[model samples]
Target: MSDYIDQTHLQIYNSNVWAYGNSKWLGYPILKYPCDLFLYQEILHEVQPDIIIECGTFNGGSAMFLCSILELIGKGKVLSIDIDPQPNLPTHERLSYLKASSTSMQALKAAREMITLEDTVLVILDSDHRKHHVLTELNLYYPLVTKGSYLIVEDTNINGHPVSPDFGPGPMEAVEDFLQSNTNFIIDEEKHKFLITFNPKGYLKRIK
Candidate 1:
């Protein structure tokens, strides 16, 4: 088990250092594993969600990617939020940006207003990976995820999914904590079929 974990860690390190550090998703730097990107594509196709709420808007590459998928799906909107302003966010008819912390009450209120009761919402928490912050975000946004959709928590591979062992409690830990009391959501293992992803076990689907 230890040996396998070590090897996986090295692969994750290489993917982060080489692939994510040196690539772009649709002309925008996207610091995400390619496998994870594929997973997102698959999920978007399968869910055909009405709205996607991305908690972190790093460079807006991922938002652009989602918007492109929405275009292909012929509908949907991307509401991306970040604590800091991104000057060069990708332009898209389906994309909206909000510069605010994902867990802030004001931001949450605005997000709720954007979501209609009939909307099938998907949320991605990629900002502030600290356990507390992720937990707060989960509590704040999980409700937006209608039944049969997803609430994805990115970067769970860090802080010892064998990468960044000393990075402290992050997305993975937060997930463990949240799942204890949350029965409506479960880890969708099929989403990890790619075998190499930055968000292992982070694909949570709402079954209720």
Candidate 2:
């Protein structure tokens, strides 16, 4: 019975109506579930990371949202990266834009230089949901997550996690492979309290 209900919810979550409903945030198309946004606020407040590294910058709404939270906390910065530059992206003192592919060596090198060993960091991977791409990103940014901080792998609900059954090996597959050899991080199931998240079991918290 529980499984049946869960499947029904997944179907709704993958429907066009759901997608169209959450297409705006602060005057921009955030393309994110409100539940996920709420979870982010909670995570940010709890972790208070010195920096938030976001791999995919869509219309800049999500980055702007994160920047606002950092401002409220009176600290932290958002480093958002994307292969294509977003025209008219919102400008914020706490936000920095990197117009480069998230998986490129250039971006990784720059990130390494920007972050110090003592800085507390959080990472969000939302670009190139392909299994290989997500796995590469997980490996590259694993070191950036500070102890007790989260590494959020967004959109893991697809590829048969109940959404997009034919999407083919994606974030969920990448996460499964990533956890096999990486013991420093573990999925924090408590984040799933909302029961409707694009990222299922993708809230990894670095324990060491």
Candidate 3:
């Protein structure tokens, strides 16, 4: 675990994630209600976006949690797409699960059909970690996101192994590819770059 996440009291929540779409069992088992929780709450309270698209719904934990925030805010929905929907089952009324490959144009089209808002705010990329795969996913989703909204790409590094690039190429490498053209979406290099001997990439904003 990185020092930042480790020292942040994430361990307080343990791994007991609520099925109420409030949150999930992701992150350290202890820091379940860490900063990420508050951040999501703020996003809900302030941005109040009507649509959220989250790719790579591993266990639906993260997706459900964010959706619950939207639910509490009185509106908004989450279109969480995953190639494999057999992970941890999620409970969310505002969540619409789509089982399809994130890299597929067909799948993207299907996801678009499920959205209720044209000006979507958030796009969380936690799907296939391969560089090419992340790049492909970015190309399609980035354009759909509203300007000033967030585009969070999770697991920038594989666990604690920053040097070990398990992703065929990686989301980090994919960022390099993306910068070739879409430079307007600048990386908050300090925030996104992992500091704990590992590089867990996180991104924000797809458009300017």
Candidate 4:
């Protein structure tokens, strides 16, 4: 359940009970969305940032995927945060975690010290789902991520549409707000099809 965890660890998570062609994670358990692995690899190659900041750590599977890539690269790591600690703790020489409210600047500052100022950093926003909550998270994380890096938001669409049962406010709303105001960020419409979700969200990579 530490840094060495690999693809073999993906077990038959409750959701995948009936699914076939079951891919596995070598060490960690729990299933994740399809884009998790894809985006992790894409970011590693395209952005190749020095520090990766993740807002959520549910089950630690996704973080393990990202951290594993960093380990393979030998120069990057993760500063992961969560309000509740997952029972399956994520470990790797490069992974550092914090158990605190992501909206707090104090917490982000503490995590900030772990990363270099000039090293490109990617911010994966997955902490809270509320519109205001996600918006607050973006405000805090946006400043830290390098200009060319990314601010990845997950679970934007809960049920295929804004009218979906679980749909309310989350990454989608927050990102929408940011885009309307910021001239530097651009939505990678070309990457739209790469997403697999309710309605799916596009990559809003920083261009300025």
lDDT of 1: 0.87
lDDT of each: 0.87, 0.89, 0.64, 0.68
Model 3 CA lDDT for position 204: 56
Per-residue lDDT of model 4, residues 55-107, tens digit only: 88766766788878777777788888888867867587888788888888767
Q: Candidate 4 — what's its lDDT?
A: 0.68
Report the poorest 10 consecutive residues by lDDT, candidate 3: 24-33
Least accurate 10 contiguous residues by lDDT in model 2: 17-26
Alpha-carbon TM-score of each model against the true structure: 0.93, 0.93, 0.72, 0.81
lDDT of 1 by residue, 55-115 (tens): 9997898899899889998989998999995677788999999988898887888788888
- Candidates ranked, most accurate by lDDT first: 2, 1, 4, 3
Candidate 4, residue 27: CA error in Å? 3.0
How many angstroms is residue 125 displaced in model 4 relative to the true structure, after the best TM-score fit?
Answer: 0.8
Model 4 earns a TM-score of 0.81
In the predicted model 1, the residue pairs found to clash are: none
Candidates 2 and 4, the one with greater TM-score: 2
Report how far residue 86 has shifted in candidate 1, in Å.
3.2
* Worst 10 contiguous positions by lDDT, candidate 4: 3-12
